[model samples]
Target: MEFSGNPALYRRIAIAVTLYINGGAFIIFALIKYLLHGDTWVLGWKPVLVTLLFSLWFGRAMYRWMMRLDAQYGRGSGWVLESVRVKLPELRPRQPR
Candidate 1:
């Protein structure tokens, strides 16, 4: 079924194309690097660790940006697939028995 005026077919196609292009570029780069050096050490752990830290730090910002974009342009399914939103609230301290 169609969703929120978005044609599922077209949405799927666009997502597929976007994933293909980005994923293909990553694969190509990795393959070339592997072929040339035959080791991941050139990429190195420090840079990878920094990237992971950056991703963790900025992931929320990225998600909010995408949410705003979706709200503005009426694009994206926006957390529909997952039931949870806004993260689970922190648990409160238990009362004394």
Candidate 2:
């Protein structure tokens, strides 16, 4: 999971993450357009185009950010969202009925 030794793997992970973010952005943008325009087809290409460009533009920044985060958190833990990883409280077993 450590990206420091393997640059190829690091770049690949960044690409995958970029694609995922681009997809999600497109979905949200499209939904918003649908709600506002009452039709998903109208100017639909704009969202697709925008998201594509957005991904391309920010992809490098993302890679850099990931590396910084990886350095900050260390041991590849940065790839895993720390905020999303919460300690779950233990649940006691219910008494047999």
Candidate 3:
């Protein structure tokens, strides 16, 4: 659950969070629009396309920001990068006959 130092993990988490947040925001906006305009925009392609574009732009921005912060503070601190070592199978090099 803790992705503190791993840039890959952090990026993935950031993307997921951004998607959820943007989706929720769009849903709320749609609800408000529905209440005000009575579904007029809901059936329109323009609104849907605009919302999709906005969400993609916002998500990309958020992802970049999160990665920058992780690199600057999280990984730089040497704490988030702390990880446990796991034992793995040992391999021996083959000798030339």
| TM-score leader | 3
Model 1 segments more than 4 A misplaced: 1-6, 41-97
Report the C-alpha lDDT of model 2 over 1-97, residue by residue, as the tens digit: 5457455666787789888888777777677878977776734677677778889877877776676666644455446544566799999999998
TM-score of each prediction: 0.36, 0.51, 0.54
Ordered by lDDT, highest first, the candidates read: 3, 2, 1
The local distance difference test score of each candidate is 0.55, 0.71, 0.72
TM-score of 2: 0.51
Task: Name every residue pair that clashes in candidate 1.
Answer: none
In angstroms, how far off is 42's CA in candidate 2? 6.1
Rank list by TM-score: 3, 2, 1
Deviation from native of the Cα of residue 79 in model 1, angstroms: 28
lDDT of 3 by residue, 18-60 (tens): 7788777777888888888787666488877877788778777
Query: Model 1 — which ten-residue stretch has the worst lDDT?
Result: 1-10
Write one digit per residue (lDDT tens) for candidate 1, span 1-97: 3334334444454455555655565557667888987968536777556545654445444444444445534354353555665877899999999
